[model samples]
Target: MAKYTLTVNGGNKEVEAMEDMPLLWVIRDLLGMKGTKFGCGQALCGACTVHLDGVAIRSCSLPVSSVGEGKITTIEGLSEGCDHPVQKAWVQHNVPQCGYCQSGQIMNAAALLTANPTPTDEEIEQGMAGNLCRCGTYNRIKEAIVTASKSL
Candidate 1:
């Protein structure tokens, strides 16, 4: 086992984990942050996406050792209050169906807008391509993103 330290959601955390243990497990199991969901163990699914030093990463495929001291942001950290523009837009657009994938979708959208506050349609599509929403809420997601971008 190895000891790794991470700055998560504005707090510092130290954990003991196996060398190959994925950060996703550490976040959910050790640290008790359930906002980052586990969809697939592989990196193909974006459900485990989190901000690692301001870059979106699939936490399931990332080793705990690689995240030492990096600023990690999960869904819980996305909003200080309950009013992140994206969250508001999501409500305004009524984007959730089953809601299982909405957290990943929102994380990806937040990353996209952080990098490009006013992304084009193609950029939006490309940025969010990795996140899959089984409910087929793509149009609503796009509309919410655009609406959030404007609000931001």
Candidate 2:
């Protein structure tokens, strides 16, 4: 096992984990932060997305060692009071159904807006294409993104 001190959210977290352990496990298991869910265990699914150094990435397949000193941000870190524009927009548009994928969805949406504060419809579709919502809330998700973009 190797010891890693990760800068998560706005704080520091130290954990001991196998070098090959996925960051998702490190975040959810060792770190005990359940906000980042486990879904496919593969990178193809965006359900395990998180922000690494302010960029959205699939944590399920990312080896913990590769994270190095990069800052990590989970859904819990997205907003302390749940007032992030995307989060508010999510509620406004009623985007979640089963809600299993909503954390990842929110994290990805937050990152998308950060990179492009005002994204076109095509751009929003493309940016959010990888995130799959099992409840088939794509239309509502799109509407939330459009709404969030306006607030940003």
Q: After best superposition, candidate 2 residue 133: deviation in angstroms?
A: 0.8
C-alpha lDDT of all candidate models, in order: 0.90, 0.93
lDDT (Cα, 0-100) at 120 in candidate 2: 91
Question: How big is the positional error of residue 8 in model 2, measured in Å on the Cα after superposition?
Answer: 0.8
Model 2: CA > 4 A from native:
none
Distance from true location, Cα of 95 in model 2, Å: 0.5
Candidate 1 lDDT over 1-152, as tens digits, reads 98887899898888899979999999999999998999988987688999998888899999998886789999999898758899999999999999988878898899999999999999999999999888899999999999999988
Candidate 1's error at 139, in angstroms? Answer: 0.5
Q: For each candidate, what TM-score against the reference?
A: 0.96, 0.98
RMSD of 1: 0.9
